[model samples]
Each structure stands twice: as structure tokens, then as C-alpha cells.
Target: MTLNTRIEAAIDGALGRATAGSVPPKLAAALYHAVKPGGARIRPTISLSVALACGDDRPALADAAASAIELIHCASLVHDDMPCFDDAAIRRGKPSVHAKYGEALALLAGDSLIVLGFDVLGVAALENPARAGRLVGEMARFTGMPHGICAGQGWESEATIDLATYHRAKTGALFTAATRMGALAAGEDPEPWTELGARIGEAFQVADDLLDALQPEAVTGKPAGQDARLARPSAVTELGVAGAIKRLEDILSGAIASIPACPGEAMLAEMVRATAARLTPAHTATAAE
Candidate 1:
């Protein structure tokens, strides 16, 4: 009934179907563990929110798109926590998939989720062929080589780094997909919504960077100081704590301003403001020190 309830149900249902069948028991179990007790469900919520704000023509399409984005996000996390990358032991307040399932199964489970994400998208596209094609293109660009999140991950190994490029791919790509798919779900042009998604995406990354800098494992539900530990490029690393907070505020304001006029504009604005406020460094200062 409520938006949050609907989104959670859809995500759970999708994850259920994704793990069904004769999946290797080990990997399937790993997949289940990886996606269970989902986090803020922000990506899907943002997608659906944009759709509702635009016009609630196709709630199903919005759900499908949201589920797909979340699947991809979860998959990325599974791989990100592998021994090669962050080598994190915990996520979502529990031992990570790799920790529970072993590296081989964890890798397979992450790959499976990536494929399943596209499968969810395909199902969504079946209902609206034209829009589905557009969504596929958008998602592919977001996940594929050269410019997608994959590229964003690869950037870490490079000698010189571009923080904007890394952030855009690592986080902004999905935000772009969420808003664009939301627009398409409402039978609207996605171009107009792109800037809003980009801003929110950047803001989300900035918040994440800030969290890495200031939040603790108890509040964040993930290992803290990862950015500094991994020496990963981050806004906070480039800009001090206060400067990063200022940048996050600027992005959040820009995101709210980018929404033209829509039925759910006010609600969307509230969500952005609330999220930004929650991520403020001042709120998490205790954790930082």
C-alpha cells in the first residue's frame, strides 16, 4: 500500500525469483544472503518516486526498473568486498557473501545477480517494447565497459584519477538509470530527468564518502574508514570534511532544483533534504573521531 512497502515487496519478490531454480546450492544461498534484509532501498525508491512524481502510469514498470537497479547495486557490493578490492568482512551488519560463501561462490553469485538484473529489465521491457529498448541501452551504458560502473571500479587501479568520472560511473550511472527508467515508465521523455538523477547520484556518492570519513560501523552498518584504508579516490579525500559537506549540500540543492514541475515534486524534495541532512558530517561527527 505504502510506497516503501510496495518497493520492499517487489524487491523481495524479485530476489526470490532470482534465486529460485537449481542454482548451485552454495551460490544460491550466497545470493539469498547477499540480497536479504535489503538496505535503504534508495535506488529503487528513487526510481519509483520519480515515476510517481512524473505520473503513475506504469507502477509495474517502475518496480521492474527499480529491482534491476538494486540487483546491480547488490551485485557490485558483493564483488567490491572480495579479497581483491575492499576485502571487507562485513556488509549490511553481517558477514559479507564472500565471507560466508567463499570466494568462488561469492563471485558466481555476484555474476548471477548482474545477469538477473537484465532479466528483470527484459521482463519490464516486454510490456513496453520501445521504452524497454531505451532502458536496455541506458542500463547497458551504465553497467558496460569504458564508461559504466565497471569502468568506475577499474579507475581505482589507474595511476592518475578523475574523481568526477569515477563518481559518475560508480554511482551516477544507476541514478541516471533510475530517473530515466522512471520517466519511461510514466511514458515521458527521460532527457529532462537526466540532470536531476545525475545530481542525486553525485550527492549519494558524496554522502557515501562522507560516511566513510565520519560514520562508524554501528551507524553505517559497514566497515568505516574504507576510503582512507584503501586509498581510494573520494571527495572527502580530495576535499576536507567540511568542504565535502558543503559540496554535498550544493549537489542536493541542485538535485531538488532540477525537478521541473511534477505531482510528486514536493515529496521528492523532502526525501532529498532528509537524506542530505542525515548524511551531514555534523550528525556523524561522533563516529568520525
Candidate 2:
């Protein structure tokens, strides 16, 4: 099957289990809403791509890794858009869970998705215990504590902030998780893949900052100027528009260089370049001058 098809299928089965019969109606629906119409699916795409590059011997395990990574991403977005966080009214250009359902249901939906992420991995364990176990550990590490997206969010609450730490956790952690888990699932040493994930994550973070700074809600499909409004540090705030774009280019260049030696190494590099091109701010016509 194609990469996107594999990803969506895995996600569909996982979400169906979570939202299936005997579940609370609204929250179940909210869970579905939070995950559907997935935007870009970049993290999982990277994970699955790396798996393919590494010779995906076991498609089930690789698909599980991709789906689980995506579930975590959806959970993060649900929490990030809540009133306590970004208070975003729209996500992927539609009403956010909390906006449509309620804060309580949104919170529950997010939490459920987080747990379901591990569940997907657990199911894969029946087929390949060793690799599935490794994937679970990797996802857990990046989903919580000092170096994950949670840490990324925690940094925002600090009296002091480190830009790199903030961006890495807030943005790069999942990308890191994506790369590592994909390798682990493919029965390859995951360590060699970390740099590529980090580079891609950092590039994505910079690109997001640029879009938030330059694009409008109509263009970005989410709130804009949040970094400035929330007093949060960002690439644009640090480097300015042109500087941030230059920084994005530099990071993507490094990302291309960081791909590990694999059968699909050239293909992976091309994907990174495609991602970089996709990441260019839509307002570039105005921002680039």
C-alpha cells in the first residue's frame, strides 16, 4: 500500500477502537474530530518514510509506529488549542474540539488519544515483541518529561526560557520520535536517525514560526501572532522575517545532509527538500521583498 494509505488505515483502525461502541458519544466524536482530516501528517510521514528507507520488513510494526506518533500529535494539538493554551477557535480550518464539544470533552479526547497511542504499539507487540517494546519506550520518552512535547509546553510556563530547548521539545520531540520509532520498527539501529529527525524538526519549527508571524488565520488555518501575544520566543521574533527564512533554508540544507545511509537515502533527501518547499510561507511574496 502507499505510505499515506498505510498511515490513514492504521489511524482509522486505532481511532475506531477508541470511538467504537460503548464509548461516550460526544467525546468519541470529539476524538474522531481531533484526528480526522489530518493536516500534512508530517511526523508520521517521516516515520513511515524512514521505515521504508530502512527496508520495512514488517509493515505492521512500522504502521503502528506511524499511527501512534500521529495520535500523540493529534492529542498535543487538542490540548494546545484549548482555552488554557492557545484558546484557538479553529484547527485545520474547522472548530476546535473545545470550541465545538466542550472543554471537558476536549480534555478527555486529548487524554484518550495519548493513551491510545501506546495502545496501538501494544497491539503491534503481539507480532513482534522486541521491536514493539522499543517503539513504545521511544514514544513514552518523547511524550513526557524533560525532553518531550510536554517539556516544550512546560518551557512556556517558565519565568525564563531557552529558545532552543523550547522549540526542540515543543516541536522537534515528535519529529525525533518519528525518526527513531520508524527505525526501531524497521529493525534498524535508531540512534543513527536522530540527527535527521532533529534537523527536520528544527526546520519545521522555524517554518511554523514564520507562518505564524507572516500569515493570517485565513491562510494558516489557525491563530496567528501567538508568539508575540503570548510573549513566547520564536524564530521570527529572534531573527526577523528574512533572517528566519534564511535560517529555515540553512536548517533544511542540514536536514538533507543528515539522512543516514539507507537504501532509500536519496529518496529521503528528496522528501526533505519537498517538505522545505512546502514549508515556505504562503506570504513569501510579501515577506521576501
Candidate 3:
């Protein structure tokens, strides 16, 4: 099967299993709604790409890692769009979970997805017990305390925020998990892939900042002007529009260069370039300038 299909199927299967047992009807439906018709599927794709590059001997483990990363991402989006946060009405080009279901159900769905992420990994562990521990540890480190996405969100609540730390945690963390977990799933040394993931994550965030600044909600599929609205730190705000674009290009360049030698190096580089192009905000900054 194609990479996208594999990722979606894995996610669907995981969600199905998690909700099949005694979950409340509304909560279970919300969980499915939160993840369906996923946007980009970038994290899981990256995980699978890295795994393929490094000899994906265990497809099931790689799929589980990818799905787990995406579940966390979707859960974060649901919470981020709540009334307490962005209060966005749309997500993935449709009504957000909080909009369709009540705020309570949306919150519960996000919480459920978080637990399900680890559960997916647990199921994958059955095949190879040794790698399971490391894979789960890497994901948790990126998903929780210290320098995880939670820390990234916490920075927003503080009087002042560190841009690098915030960006790394909120966005770069999952990319790091994607690469490292992909390597771990393939029985390869994950350390070498770390910088590549970090660079890619940083690039993606910068690109997102540009999109938030330059694109409309219709095109971006989420609220525009969020950083400005929320008084959140953004690369485009910190660096000017042109400067953020330059930074994105620089980071993507570094990401491509940082790819550790693997059989699929050329293909991976192409994928990064294509993703960079796709991620560039619809309008050139000159127009906004």
C-alpha cells in the first residue's frame, strides 16, 4: 500500500480498537471525527520515510510509531482550537470537534487520543519488546513535560516566552519523534537522525508562521491572524515576513543536508523540497510588503 494509505489505515484501526470497548457514544464519535480526513499527515509520513530510508524491517512498528505521532498531533489541534485557546470554528476545512460536539466532548476526545497514542505503541510492542520501550519513551518526552508540546503551550501562559524553546517544543518535538522513532522501528541508531528532524520541524513552523500571516482561513483551513490575535510569538512576527521566509529556506536546506546516509537519501531530499514548496505561503511576501 501507499504510504498515505498505510498511515491512515493504521490510525483508523487504532482509533477503532480504542473506541470499540465501553467508550461513551459521543466521546467515541468525537475521537473518530477529530482524526478523520487528516490534514497533511506530515508527521507520520516523515516517520515512514525515515524508516524506509533506514531499512524498514518492521512495517508494523513503523506504522504504529507514525500513527502515535499523528494521534498526538490531532489531539493537540483539538485542544488548541478550543474556547480557551484559539476558539477556532474550523479545522481540516470543516467544523472543529468543539464546534460539532460540545466543548466537554471535544476535551474528552483530545484526552482520549493522547492515551490512545501510547496504546497504539503498546500494541506494536508485541512484535519486538526491546524497541517498544525506547519508542514509547521518545514519544512521551516530546508529548509531555520539560520540553514537550505541553511546555510549548505553557510558554504561551508565561509573561515572556523563549521563541526557540517554544518552537522546538510545540512543533519540532513531534518531528524529532518522527525521525527517531522511525530509526528505532527500523533497528537503526536514532541519534544520527535527530538534527534532521529538528531542522525539518523548525522549517515547518516557520512556514506555518508565514501561512498564518499571509494566507486566509479558506486556504489555510484554520484561522488566520492567530499569532497576532492570541499575542503568541511567531517567526513572522519576530523576524519580518521576508526574514521568516529566508529562515524557512535556510532550515529546509539544513534539513536536506542533515539527512544521514541511507539508501533512499535522494528520494527523501526530494520529498523535503516538495514539502517546502507546498508549505510556502500562497502569496509572496512582496505583495504583503
Tens-place lDDT digits, model 2, residues 1-289: 8889999999999998887778788888999899998999999999999999999999999999999999999999999999988999999999999999999999999999999999999999998999999998999899899799999998877898887888888899999999999999999999999999999999998888888888889888998888889877778888888898889889999988889889999989988988887889456636866
State each model's C-alpha RMSD to the native: 1.9, 1.0, 1.4
- On lDDT, the leading prediction is 2
Quote the RMSD, in angstroms, for model 1: 1.9
Model 1: worst 10 consecutive residues (lDDT sum): 280-289
* Global lDDT of each candidate: 0.83, 0.92, 0.90
- lDDT accuracy of residue 54 in candidate 1: 83
Comparing 1 and 3 on TM-score, the stronger one = 3
Q: In candidate 3, which residue ranges exceed 4 Å CA deviation? A: 281-289
Per-residue C-alpha lDDT of model 3 across residues 1-289, encoded as one tens digit per residue: 9999999999999988987877689998899899998999999999999999988999999999999999999999999999998899999889999999989999999999999999999988887888987899999999999988988888878887777888899899999999999999999999999998999999999888888888888888888898898777788888898899888889999999999999989988988897787787447555446
Query: In candidate 1, what are the lDDT values of residues 1-289, reduced to their tens digit?
Result: 7767877777777777876777667777887888878888788778888888888687887787778888888999999999998899999999999999899988998999899888887887778777777777888888877788899888888899887888898888888888887887788888999998899899888889988878779878889898888777788888887788778889898999998687888988987787676656467554344
In model 1, the runs with Cα more than 4 Å from the true position are: 285-289
